[model samples]
Target: MAFTCTIPAVATLQQDDEAIRITRWDFEPGAVTGWHSHGWPYFVVMLVDGTLRIHDGEKATDVPLVQGQAYMRQAGIQHDVMNGSPHPIAFIEIEVKQPAALKQLAA
Candidate 1:
């Protein structure tokens, strides 16, 4: 079954520029960000210790997160992020923009 949020996750735009886009997500119990894909590489900084369920279409994985923990994911990851905990959880997402020079260097 596809995951749907009864109450959508709250996203606060922290910054948006040519370099990157920063957003803070607040998820209440059973809240979900819905199915989506990242266009660019991004990093996540956990603001609270809680359990999050990440569904990558085929399966769902429960990830235990701790406050201040951070991780990075490459572009094109399609998934739904859900708050699996009973309490509220939050995280900061920073999307990395590849500058023209950086893209060329990677080639």
Candidate 2:
């Protein structure tokens, strides 16, 4: 089932290239990102100290966030994200689209 929301968060594309795509997301309390999946592995750096409510297909999980802290997830992750905090929340998402050759070169 596709996740839908009444109010969605703001997602700004900061950068997009062959190897990566970066987005800055801002959300008011109760705002959602809707249901989605990433084609590449991604990392997220939380911009504020707050909690995010994530629906991971089966259940909803409220996760705590710390400013400047980062977390990563593999590709094909599907979920809906919501700002559970009373205050506004922001974060930077980095999607790695590195090709096999590029990944080998970096290794």
Best by lDDT: 1
Candidate 1 versus the native: TM-score? 0.88
lDDT of 1 by residue, 1-107 (tens): 44766678999999988878899999999999988989989999999998989988888899999999999999999999899999999999999886442454444
Q: Check candidate 2 and list the clashing pairs.
A: none
TM-score for each model: 0.88, 0.88
RMSD of each: 3.2, 2.3
Query: Looking at model 2, how many pairs of residues clash?
Result: 0
Instruction: Summing lDDT over every window of 10 consecutive residues in candidate 1, give the lowest-scoring window.
Output: 98-107
Would you list the C-alpha lDDT of every candidate in the order shown? 0.89, 0.88
List candidate 1 stretches off by more than 4 Å: 99-107
Compared with the true structure, what per-residue lDDT tens digits does model 2 show for residues 12-81?
9999998888999999998999998889999999988989899988888999989999999999999999
Q: What is the lDDT of candidate 2?
A: 0.88
